[model samples]
Target: MSSFDLTEDQQDCLQELINVAMGQASDQLARYLDTFVYLKVPSIEQVKSEHLFETLNQDLKATAVVSQGFFGYEGIRGEALLMYQPQDSHRLADLLGYEADELTFDEQIIDLSSILTTTFLNVFASQIDNQMSYSAPRLLSANQGTISEHLNQQSFNWDLALKVRISYQVTDYSFNCDMVLLIPEEAINNIKAVIDRILEDF
Candidate 1:
């Protein structure tokens, strides 16, 4: 089997691609919420499934996580998770113009996750000349446990995951969230091939 790791050139190419995609997603999100969105540089790396959450630089304590699965051509597939810190939930509710009731809050969380996941992945897939389909976004945990604990309970078919981490913050508001893409080992080779073709074209 091919190695899951990407070459330096492939990594650079993929990161650039994701940067462009994220820019578009950020624009759409800003328009949707009528607020400026701040984005951090996205990082991509391969990590053991067990150490997934540990790789993040941010403290993910008391997070509410929503996960959605997406698949595309060339075996490009993975699960995308949007994690929100509960402390910002009220701010998010305010931005959405919704009451901070539990039911409405939960519904808005899923709605926001769906928007972020679909918009980002759709742009990313289009860049690679592919289309993606998504599964319903489900809430994994709601301010109940650590992000690591929530993920540990779930089973992953692959040992290694290509994790792409992107963080978003709304200007002048404490609303912040992290979007993570977990691509299995088997899909890494496919992604590498696609990156190679893109590099060749440039």
Candidate 2:
């Protein structure tokens, strides 16, 4: 039996896998917006549940909302989240050719948002899964308030967190999206075990 802590190589692999996933996410966004999308590598930061708001505030000055859930293979599960400043949502909707103010919580927008979120999760998860040789990914959406709501939670198991941020410029409008990864503490041990097995075999 091996200790749960991840080896240095495992950490590097996780980061590399996340980078690939984020790159795929950015490409998908570019295709959807029909314009180049500027992206930054996801970062891992230690944050206190109480200070979540402050942390989110540092990256964005407006009301920050988040949508989160877990997705991945049978055992090698991965968590996912989408967060952004509330104001950015309006610009993002507009980039998709939607009038933010005109659109209400109608099923159409809700359904569309679900679809968009699913696509983003799928693309990102698929890339990471490929790199790790994991099973197909699964996606879940939070029915909470907004993006900020879930992210601000006092506690959520995320032993490994990766955040991919995007800033888009379409015409005069600016769009922002943050793709976050959250893995439960248990999964950290599982992932480390998987890495150890691989290392032993080689």
Candidate 3:
């Protein structure tokens, strides 16, 4: 039971919208990994920038990171961060027959990440966009140290942002992926508007 600037209806809409986005991600993952992929009922949260790692530390420590962003028609909107356990990501890479070195700069690797980003966010943004018409999202990320430092150095407006946690599970495997969805504080009102729209649709 946590308090948020968003109303209960907003939260529910966010959940439903994420469900659709997760489905899109799973579809892309299944095709890309050449294995069946499924997702759990994703969990959402709102937290400060400094507490990000602490909030998701337990779920993130074991995973290799794969993240991107979600933009809407209005412009740069929110971000999407995905983390897969090392073993699982390694298995996925191997399943795709990618060598260790190939994972970083290979054409397939680049295309895969891009495709995942485009597909996942396009659907996600669209769902939320239907309500508030968010601007298009641009994906961003780097290695663990870089990502951590980048966020740490930035000045954040806490009042306007929210953190959405989306967890994924493979239908035929024991692997799990946790996705962190974040929107800046200034965009919080827009996000809530999208959530409200979703709730109305329901």
Candidate 4:
């Protein structure tokens, strides 16, 4: 893997941390919605940042998007994105406690993405034992091409990114969304080191 100086064992250990982070995200959603939230098993992948949209296109349509950039005191930094198709929008709207047709579809997407991204950042920052802060998330045009296209357009040519994707559904309703966390390759080594330290402590 292009995980900087991380070893195979360290990679496995790093995933354990991600599992915990996912759980935290799940719990937050369940409590906020006051319903059971089922998070599918998450998978980790190492790929060029440019390949993100193409790779995820098979499973994600990304008709809507919310993107946020984050950074921490220890120098670990990157962005988090939440994307879903129009068909999946109503489900997400309901999960946010809105009637399917109540809010402007774009409004619902913004609300949903903001909630998920904040929860993710909290758990992730806590796990890595760093003080990470986020910039105000800017809503983007859904008409924009694939998510990868947006990233490329931004001129952020990342060589590699570690992607952890989890699909979640609200058990009480037919609502589900895919959450993808992208950590740059440069941050992976620092993240691995942090997770390793946590494992050693326990």
Q: Which structure among the candidates has the greatest TM-score?
A: 1
TM-score: the better of candidates 1 and 4: 1
Tens-place lDDT digits, model 1, residues 1-202: 2377888899899999999998988898788888888779998888886677678535666889999999999999999999888877777666775666745778888988888889899989999999999999999878787877876777766689899989888866777898999898888888888999999999
TM-score of each prediction: 0.91, 0.62, 0.68, 0.82
How many steric clashes between backbone atoms does each model show?
Answer: 0, 4, 13, 0
Clashing pairs in 1: none
The runs of at least 3 residues in candidate 3 whose Cα sits more than 4 Å from the true structure, single-residue gaps closed, are 1-4, 97-116, 128-160, 171-174, 197-202
- Name the better of 2 and 3 by lDDT: 3
Candidates in descending TM-score order? 1, 4, 3, 2
Question: Which runs in model 1 stand beyond 4 Å of their true positions?
Answer: 56-58, 97-103
Error of 1 at 158 (Å): 1.6
Model 1: residue 199 alpha-carbon error in angstroms: 1.1
Query: Candidate 2 vs. truth: CA RMSD?
Result: 6.0
The residue-by-residue lDDT of candidate 2 on 1-202, one tens digit each, is 2354455787666566556755776687668767666656556543434544554545444433334354456355554444444554445555665666666523223433444455555765565442222222322322334434544444654433323333323334565555555455566666656556555655
